[model samples]
Target: MAVTDLNPSDNDQSFRCTGALTIGRAGSTQRELDAMPDGMTIDLAGVDRMDTVGAWLIHRTQRDRGAHIVGESAAVKALLEQVAAADHPVQVRPDLRPAPTRALAELGTWTVEVGQTLFGLLGFFGATLVGFGNVIRRPKRFRMNAVVSSFDAVGVRALGIIGLMSFLIGVVIGQQGAVQLQQFGAEVYTINLIGRLTVRELGPLMTAIMVAGRSGSAFAAQIGTMKITEEIDAMRTIGVSPVEALVVPRMLATVLMMPLLSFFSMLTAIIGGGVFCWVSLKITPATYAMRISEVVPLHDLDVGLIKSLVFGFIIALGGCFQGMLVEGNSEEVGRRTTNAVVQSIFMVIVLDAVFAVFFSSIGWL
Candidate 1:
């Protein structure tokens, strides 16, 4: 590289820059340029090669010192123009907003997302009903094998855990109810408390929660993987309805199993409460059974069965809906699976409240 003064004066001085003007000599070149006064002429006619770094340095010197660039080839002129065009102010710091404003914006976004999801779920449910209708019209299209497989998976495999959970919950309820009743010398009514609570609420509710966490997540993960793998698309290509082949069978299995599981949960819970009474309250099994039969109404059992059926429907709907919505990579399978469980459990609780209000209004409570 070489620099020579062409015409020197207190104002309007000129200098010629030659050789390769690039990153290698950018530091020295910048220092040399800084020594020159502003409003000078920079001659690039002798520059053999000028890259982006060189252009940036020259452009900066020209802007800061009011230097005029002159005498450049086409390529150098274009490169300099591009570098100059790219210069602009850019914001570096993050934009901060007031806390309340940020919170309101987040709330609005959440509300919109929830509305969209709800709309999509409703559409999916309608498609499921259409699939069910088609199967009903053509009985042979029903997949009995898939339904049986789902039954074994969702119902039979779940019995041990459901029973254990129910037993523990019953023991807790019995122990706590006894403690409270003992304060009023009404320990004998512990049977009524346990029997009524188990049959009317806890048994079916707990079973639904367990099913949402277990079978619901499984449904979403399985179907989501299928969606990601394009298996659902393949089914459609082969003239198979995904809803009929995949979703309906699983939903039917869940709906059929819920009432049975709820009943099993109820009996196990009652037995657990009875066991606790026998051990701690000096009550015999025979007396416990007699009291349970006398105090717990048949209507209470009906309430549990009804709730179980609805809960089963909602759980299957949420799982299958989330699964059908899956797209993109394998990570979507995990996200949809979690969404299935959360949506199912949340919907179940909301519907449970609705049912309670409805039943109470109708004098069934």
Candidate 2:
């Protein structure tokens, strides 16, 4: 095939092609076309094996000036059709709203379902206690290892974090109190404020929050994973009650550890408070000790310990309950673990409030 150029005038230029415009040859053709005058027509009658790039160049030339193709080949026509189609825009509509009333109704239904589930859990706990009592009478099918493992996990593992947090809390309380009391020339009384607050409220509350974040989430994830794998069912098939094997031991461990952990936290917080007082307020250790001794009563310590124990029980129970409810899926395990931490923290705060109200009403505060 031959390539020929026809100049209709000094300005009117056109090119005639008579060969395949393959990818390799298209680049040379493009350079030749580029050298032509701006308004030029290219005829593709003799061209063969037209591709997307050649079609695009033709379309672009037609857009810039004009082109006349004498050949009506199906491939060329199809490529031109595609280029024409590409120039049009597509419209899309997006749906952004979900039905609000339907969502509210579903939420209400879920709340009722959760309430019923809690009721069933309480019933199950009662029955497990009865079964435990009967089993104790005969002493059969009991695993000591599980109990010991749980105790170590929930108790020993939680001690360090609880101690550290409590100490920091004490320092914060002491520093804050010292700042306020310094205005009244009562900087020495900061120690009294720290001791009283730590022993009565902050100690138990902080300890409980720490445990919820640490051990409570651990319990939920462990049990929830077991549930997902149907290990709880396997345990039941082997004549082992899941509650006896799992929940009871955890509950016992938490109940025993919480008060002890709270005590450690309280001590650390007081030590922190002491350091803050000595450094910030320039109060002597003797004066701080005397103030603490005068302000903190034995009953206040008792109340805090009691609150810690209660918070521990709540945390353990919430963790186990959420874990047991896990529905044998990865998402469910994650959801339940989150639920355990949130529920445990909420319960701890609510119980703390209740205790505060009771103590205040009875003149303990």
Q: What is the TM-score of each candidate against the true structure?
A: 0.86, 0.69
Model 2 lowest lDDT segment of ten: 1-10
- Show pairs that collide, candidate 1: none
lDDT of candidate 1 over 1-365, digit per residue (tens): 74848453444567678999999988988888877787878899999999999999889888788899999889999999999999997989968899999999999999998999999999999999999999999999999999999999999999999999999888899999999999999999999999999999999999999999999999999999999999999999999999999999999999999999999999999989999999999999999999999999899999999999999999999999999989999899999999999989999999888988988899886
RMSD of every prediction: 3.7, 9.5
For candidate 1, give the lDDT of residue 107.
Answer: 100
Error of 1 at 362 (Å): 0.9
Q: What is the C-alpha lDDT of each candidate?
A: 0.93, 0.82
**Superposition error at 241 for model 1 (Å):** 1.8
Local error of candidate 1 at residue 126 (angstroms): 0.4
Residue 263, model 2, lDDT: 87
lDDT of 1: 0.93
lDDT, residue 240, candidate 2:
78
Best by lDDT: 1
